[model samples]
Target: MTRHHSPTARLAARMGSGLALGALALGLASQATAAEDYRPQPDQTPIQSSKNESFFGKTMDYIENNSYGRLGVLRFQYYGSSSNLHVDNATGLAAQAFGPGGSDLPHTGSSAGNTTTLGAMIGLYLPKTNHHLAMEVQLAPPLKLDFQVSGDAVDQSLAPTALNGANGGSIPTGVPPLGKNLGTFKALPPNFTIVYRPWTHTLVQPYVGVGAMYLYTYDKDVNNKVLNAYGEPSLYLSKPVACVGQLGSDFNLPNNMFLNLDVKYVGCADVKSRVSNIKVNSPTLSPTFGPVDVGSVSSTNHFRAVLYQISFGMHF
Candidate 1:
């Protein structure tokens, strides 16, 4: 077929080419529309709720970041007795027993006191594990203690003649009463507490803590000479170390305030106490005694435990 192409033949061929290109474009458009319909939507993201939010919230997370700073707290407490204080009457000598020389003869005679105590607490709170946990070291001031003593009825004094050449030891008349005031002193040993408050709230906060408490007392000035009728005027100083354990809750109030109440147990230890006593013989009212050292005061395993606390504080 070597014949030259006619105009009509060329026009027909160009028209066929144009029709094929149009069909291909239509197919591509349709495919794109179908693919869009098959794709996923925007609403399918993960979902979470609010009530599940607990102490594990971002609030406590800051504490883990080493962001906890300085803090201070104050508390007032009223403690109840869990046990009785057993004063060692056998370890230390009474002033009446020690003649003129200060002898350390594993002294005898121990005085017992009531276990209940009421006191105040001042503390400095330091962040250890951020805001979730902290260290609170506090001071409990000298507290007024009520005391009692009881046992087999034994004469407090042997025959006065046993020591003074018998006018014959005349046993003093009248039995001693059940209760007495032991006097007050300063707070030397403070308390150490490890505190944890999970979430800070408006009304109530649940907290857990533990502590080691010590009370160091000053020289007690005993003025009532009637208690020591066997000798002259005197004074005493005592140092007692007690191991303490505690637990409690804090109720936060308005105006940067709060209330703290706690129950605590103070374990007893070996007590070494100092004492001085005096007395005047009949006839010559002149003072016939001087100060003496009564050493090694006896104590037992049971001591004081306290409850109830009302306080106010500012948070940092």
Candidate 2:
């Protein structure tokens, strides 16, 4: 139904209709803009993949492209070491008694020989240094070392009687009197080092390290014929801890294996030793002496050692 109205009312009705149409057009434009924004473009398309490809294959590809994955984090090595050890002659009773001039008293100093042993090393690579720095721990089993006393006869006057005594249990009467044999011992040395490598990808990589080492000696054998005449003798040694320096080179081989030559120098260490349980045996003693307890004798010895090692290593 249509109703006639005044001119002013007709103009107002027209204005209201124009406003409603403008609002409807604005709503339609906003909807169109949002739809265009969500639509995928050429650059936003998903990449295609082969159906036969696997997660393991993708992981291996990623590892081959990464540096850390190629170099690994841990290394293991097995080696053989030859140690050249030099121990200075002991002091105290050892010096006075074992000196060139002989007296009617117990005198002898201890000397150590060199040894060879098997060893192993484990190393860890530090992060973010491109394999330039690492920490290593090296260990070896007990090595056998022979100890002896070096000097002239204890008492030249009683030397003849002692040499000719029962079972030759007195003084050693050899041509030069080559001292007394103190027997063998076992020494174990272990070290921890921080190593630096200058070149990582070279065929021959050289490294230098500084560290600390500890020496432990045990299984003492005091079976000397001359010392046993007095009584059962007990031998004791002080453990030494010292600083060590290392220099080494590694030659790369196939299949992640390497051949290494390493040299280490241990600083001078002072070691002390004691020999106890000395009972005077009248038979071996001079005529002026009587049977009595002589207590114990102590000596100070200085030691220095150099280790040369050849090793085979693998990275993991």
Candidate 3:
């Protein structure tokens, strides 16, 4: 035990002792840093109240904290719609005379054109229910309803002699006839819908809805050519209540304002149109007949139309 160690051995032992001390110091510093990180800070807010909280609970908490006020939203919408009308069946004496290739007038199966117009709607979400239900009312300018008619029907119905025979005197000429332009009318449609929202935490919220609408048609304007043809024809259209389906998305903007894009489909219902007028002697009839007034004739047509609408809206 009294023997002294060599210089190389002593150097190796000193080096190993220094390395063990350094490792011990590094480990202590790492433990101190981990303990500091685990300690909660005074200003830090917990993301969850409990570690066992479910994802649904977290989502609801987020929605409750971040949602806008539950007070209802009012929206003003500008929309355009295209409608198609199909004639199902027709009846009455006028139908008999004009029954598809008859001498007087041709049968009309459907509208010759589409009614494309600009419309406006005002909608309000019912208070409560987090803006999930709404009611909307819409108004549009006069819409033209063009029905199919033959060129021969136009010429024969508006002939000078025929006009005089129907009117019982010399009538004015040179006025152009409204060929296929049957009439025009205005519509008042109101809707009630229940909306569904999939993502409530994002700025862009998309939704779908199903509803019903009452379509009130009024202010009928029959073409003068039609009137002259039938010697004072009166037109009538039945009001219908139809189902509605819609899809849309809303984009939140600054200052409580939002922009919306929407599309809707209005389901078909039984709609009817009736035309009643006094029949008169035509040029094709015997020439000996002198402006003879015939009995009144009428025709009824049952039809339905499906309307498609695209709209852009703004929040109030």
The RMSD of every model to the true structure, in order and in angstroms, is 31.7, 29.9, 29.6
**CA RMSD (A), model 3:** 29.6
Model 1, residue 31: C-alpha shift (Å): 63
On lDDT, the stronger of 1 and 2 is 2
Report every candidate's CA lDDT.
0.38, 0.52, 0.45
- Give all TM-scores, in the order shown: 0.47, 0.56, 0.50
Candidate 2 colliding pairs: 97-107
Q: Per-residue lDDT for 1-316 in model 1, tens only?
A: 1123455864575466447533443332233221212111122221221345443332232222221122223232323222222222322223334333333222223343433233454332232232345455444434433222223212332112112324655323222322343233333335656667776543676667776665544434443333344543333434556666666666765544566665555555443433333332322211332322232222232345453444454342
Worst lDDT window (10 residues) for model 2? 66-75
* Lowest lDDT 10-residue stretch of candidate 1: 34-43
Lowest summed lDDT across 10 adjacent residues in model 3 is found at: 33-42
Each prediction's total of clashing residue pairs, residues at least 3 apart in sequence or on different chains, is 23, 1, 0
Residue lDDT tens for model 3, 142-240: 354453333433444433332344646643333233366665655544455656767644788898877776655555555545345545555566667
Error of 2 at 206 (Å): 0.9
Q: How big is the positional error of residue 304 in model 3, measured in Å on the Cα after superposition?
A: 5.7
Ranked by TM-score from best down, the candidates are: 2, 3, 1
